[model samples]
Target: MPDRVRPMRTVPRLGTYNGFGRTLLGRTKPDADGACFATHWFTLLLLPIRPLGRYYVKEGATVERSTGPGASTSTTEYVFLGEAELRASEVIRTYLFRWVVVPLVVAGPVTVFGLNSDAYSREHPLLFLLLLLGIPIGGIIVLAVALGLREKFLSSARVPEWVGSGPPRG
Candidate 1:
C-alpha cells in the first residue's frame, strides 16, 4: 500500500511569557499505520556559574490510534520527570527567591558583621572576595534544594488533566 500523506496541523499557543518565551501544544493526526503523536514546548531557564540563559525544552508522546475499527483509542502518556508543572510566574519567582533572595539573606548578615569589625576587615581582606563568591554558591545551593523539593512534589502528585489535552486546534 502507498504511504498516506498526513496533513500538517497548526499547534496551539497556550500562554505568553514576556516576549522572550512561549508555550506550544500540538498533536499529529493518526497516520496510515494508526499511530498518533503529541508534542509540547515550554521555555526553561538555564543558570550557569557565570552567565544565565533561557532555552526551550520539547517533550512529546506517541501511541496507537485505536485497537480496531471503531474501537477506543489508547494513548501512552508522557510526563516530565523530576519537574513540576509551574506557571511562568512561579518559575520566575522560584529563581528569584532561590537565586537572589536566599543568597542576600545569607550574605547580608555576614557582610554587616565583616564590615563592623575593623580588625577582621583589615586582617582578612580576602573575606570580602569570599563573600562576593559566596553569593553564587549560596544561590546554587538554594537552586539544588528547590529542584529537589520540586522533584519530590511532582513525583508524589498526579499529572494535571489539562496537560494530557492535546493543544487546542483552530
Candidate 2:
C-alpha cells in the first residue's frame, strides 16, 4: 500500500490594530504598511434630547492581494482614497444647529407647557408628566435612527468599491 501525504495549510499574516484619535468621539486603527483606518462619531446633546444622535465618518486605505507565478508567491498592494480630514468649521456648524438652534426652537413649546402646567396637570396629571418625559426620550430615539441611516448612506456613498482596491497611502 502507498502512503498518503498531507496537504500544507496557509496562514494569514497578522498586523497591528491600534486605535488613536482626538474628538468628541473618534478612533484610528493602524493597518499593514503606513496606512491606518479612522472613524468619527459625532453627537448632539442639547434641547430635550439628552443624547441627540450620532454621525459617523471613516477614512482609510484599500488593500489588495494578488498571487504571483507560484502558489507561495503573493503580493500585497495599497491605495489611499477617502476623506482624510474632519474640518473644524463643519463640526462647529453641526454643533450650533443641534445645541443652539434646536433648543431655541423647542423653547416655545416648553415655555407654553411650563406656564400651563397647573391647568394641564389638573386636567390630566399623568399625561402632562408623560409629555414632559417623553419629549427627551422620543427625541433621542428618533434622532438616533435618523443618524444611523445617515451614517449608512454616507459610508456607502464614500466608496462603493472599497473592497479589494488596495492599501492607502499618506
Best by TM-score: 2
Least accurate stretch of 10 residues (summed lDDT) in model 2? 1-10
Q: What overall lDDT, based on C-alpha atoms, would model 1 receive against the true structure?
A: 0.42
Residue-wise C-alpha lDDT for candidate 2, range 35-148, written one tens digit per residue: 332223322232122221222223334454545654332223323233333435445555565667556544545566778688878899899888877765665666677667
Cα displacement (angstroms), candidate 2, residue 21, comes to 14
Model 2 ranges with Cα > 4 A deviation: 1-23, 26-89, 101-109, 154-170
Colliding pairs, model 1: none
Q: Locate the minimum summed-lDDT window of 10 residues in model 1.
A: 48-57
- CA lDDT of every candidate: 0.42, 0.40
